[model samples]
Target: MTILNNKESMRVTLKSVTVPSIPLAALLVIACSGLWFSSYWGARLALFPNQTTEIVNHLQKIIVPNTLLSEIISFFLTLLNAFLLAQINNKFTIIRTRTFLPILVFMTLMGTWNETHLANGSHISLTLFILSLFSFFSMSRNRNSSEQAFMGSFLISISSILINPLIFLIPVCWIGFGMFQSLSLKTFLASLMGGLTPWILYLALNFIINPHFNVLQALILNPNFVLDISTYSLPDLVYFALMSIIIIMGIVGLYSTAHSDAIDTRNKLNFLVFLLISLCVICFIFINQFVSFLPIIALVYALLFSHPLTLKQNNFHSILFIVFCVINLVYAVSKYILT
Candidate 1:
């Protein structure tokens, strides 16, 4: 009985720390800023692909990697993403409570990954993807969802111009619209039109600029399906394995307690789960080609993971959260300081 009481007290203490408050938010900002600075300094440890798509190549020519301007842009974009994440949770109540834990988790994930400290096409694409979610979630049970569908798919189509593999998400978004009961013939046609509009405009612009330009070839998604796990360093492999475990735990926790949420909230959360799974598959298949998608993946993981971490008041979850934070710190130290 005494041991049980002590464990309960510990759980309560940890739960209080996880609560969303102004002081906690400020502290997180300071800590994440420090981490981001360290990551920027250790950017040399990141392994970038030698060759990339023509669009990304063009983007790099403008952004110019390893520059202070690029790092500053990336940092501000991360902050913007954190703000958007908090807004998404507050607007939709996806976590069933008003909390900033998603922002905390997301910033921690972003700061730990050295590769994300540089401005890239993936950063821009992720911002667009999250914006699309705002439109997509608003379409739940909305009778006139054609406009939202168009806007959402239009944003995603623009994102695909940067990260070509993201084009596959259009079908996933359509399936999500079906789950939300907002998929009608009109909305379907609108989404289809929205998905094609960007490509059409890009093709036309390219034709006007250079009639011989091969826009179709530029749009092709050439994913390297080979799983080259052996290429990763020991620390990277361990870090990735830990992240995979956290993802599995979050998914299991979500399904275990999903019945408690409101129907609307549940449907929205289900769409997130479906979208997260689809993104994971895309990442797995195209990891070599599109590692920039990590920030987007981290965004979804933070949302799903926060649900159970913030709500579950058990000692097991509290301990898990503590371990999660410690692991992130250690990984950051290993990459940025030790290396």
Candidate 2:
């Protein structure tokens, strides 16, 4: 446990073990730890079926099970998202130090899912968003991969939109990234085509079955935003407070290094942080209108928050890091006991 006190040791622990996905295994164990609180764990599935397309609605029904299997599958999906996120960070040298973003993501998730949870369509779209980001990032310095990257990014974005119509704003961010990467017209066109392809096929099938079904109307009129966070209880507020503090610390850490890092690295990381915060803003203000998008923010927060731990910035970061962990874990345990 002393590794928790040192940055280098923590980095090695995450980076050295990937073959068997030790980080993911550890996350699973932590997620399953909620079983002890199962009595208090209510069904907290956040699904907006009316806003979703038929394809995603069917998926929602099938993906959500009342049994323990749903939790296992949800955790697995979360791990996949974390792994993909870590891959992006490593490939682009975002954090530089080889730290596991998944662990950070899991810890943030613990605050949300301790009492009740579900791997809803919103969570599923998050994974798709990560895949789209992976494709977008893969095109960073490789011109030859532009078409594939753009196509994949668009395809995933479109799919995610179908699942959670609220994510329709994300493609704009992708377009911004495409511009930042200096994408070619062909690549841009390819992305547009890729996004349209799903709709084309879906409409074609729908027309054959139901002549009155209008894809355009479906696209234009689906999402109904429900904006209310007042229902959040005391425990929820405490969890949010802890998460916010961590994110603030992470932002401070990243800001401190902005001018010191290499230009290209700083620019890329800044763009990513900007895009993540943009998405979070959108999620909070419009789309999700809830803390459901904390996982997405958690991924970005983990990356930035991790920067402070990579260097020996006095013992302040170490103290803060340990304190944060202890608070969250203690909160989880105490919540379970009291419930």
Candidate 3:
């Protein structure tokens, strides 16, 4: 019985080691392939947009070309992204447990789907933000120094915008990522260049696809740009409000945690605070699409900070925060195109 159990354990460990590499490569192939389709089709809903929709519509545009170089490149980028995001946990305090992966894969798939599906509505502006949130949660489960944590964040932000340039909004994280990593200026510039490289390619591709590139249109910044918002139903408003309340409480938790005397957790808590502030600014400057991006980041930060707030401490504020998310989600049911 012991020998059989040991054999099973060894097989499981070996398989676990090998499986992530292939699926990770496959995921990036699918994600990058989604971008290729985006170029050809323009981000649009043919008939289905939801993840719950038929798999054919969602996966149809993703073509895994079997070329060696393309596959290798796809594989490497995905590995780097995943490593920056989740590999720290195994490397540091270095747990041998296999539980972290399912959640990681789930988020990767959902996040990629969100990025791809929403490309038309909210993808471009929120690009850096959404990817940063995904990376934050992925790394939240690890043991990393302040510097390592910062670099991980920086690289993720820089890497995210490589696919979508509008992500330049999270410059704070890119800067912080570099600073936290204690990287030399050359390495920092190299990563920054890497981030912008995709956008440069995007322009070249634009020229190839359309000879007379609308240089003026691409460069023009509306001096008085305002978002165009459609009407929202009552339920949509409710859900939006509920989501907001939950977020505020989470931020409050972050503040409480950051001020702690515990030196160990201060830096991470502070990092979360920095992320929240940056996210808030993006929400203000860019678009309201940032609301959904808030809850998860806040929740993850709350977990890291772990400052339990009692109703006695601030009853009214706590109640209001919880109320907001409920109202917001309710509103979203009727008003939102994406759930």
The numbered model that scores best in lDDT is 1
Residue 81's lDDT in candidate 3: 41
Candidate 3 versus the native: TM-score?
0.45
Q: How does model 2 score by TM-score?
A: 0.75
Which pairs of residues have clashing backbones in candidate 2?
Answer: none
lDDT of each: 0.81, 0.58, 0.39
Q: Which candidate number maximizes TM-score?
A: 1
lDDT of prediction 1: 0.81
lDDT agreement of model 2 with the native? 0.58
Write candidate 3's Cα lDDT for 149-249 as tens digits: 34434544443332222354346544444334433554445446644555566567777988998645543322222555454444545544654555566
Give candidate 2 misplaced runs (Cα > 4 Å): 1-52, 107-111, 114-117, 141-145, 169-187, 220-229, 287-292, 330-339
* Model 1 residue 180 lDDT score: 92
Worst 10 residues of 1 by lDDT: 1-10
User: By the lDDT metric, which is better: model 1 or model 3?
Assistant: 1
Candidates' TM-scores? 0.92, 0.75, 0.45
Model 3, stretches more than 4 Å misplaced?
Answer: 1-165, 178-184, 208-210, 219-230, 233-238, 257-265, 288-339
For candidate 2, give the lDDT of residue 42.
Answer: 44
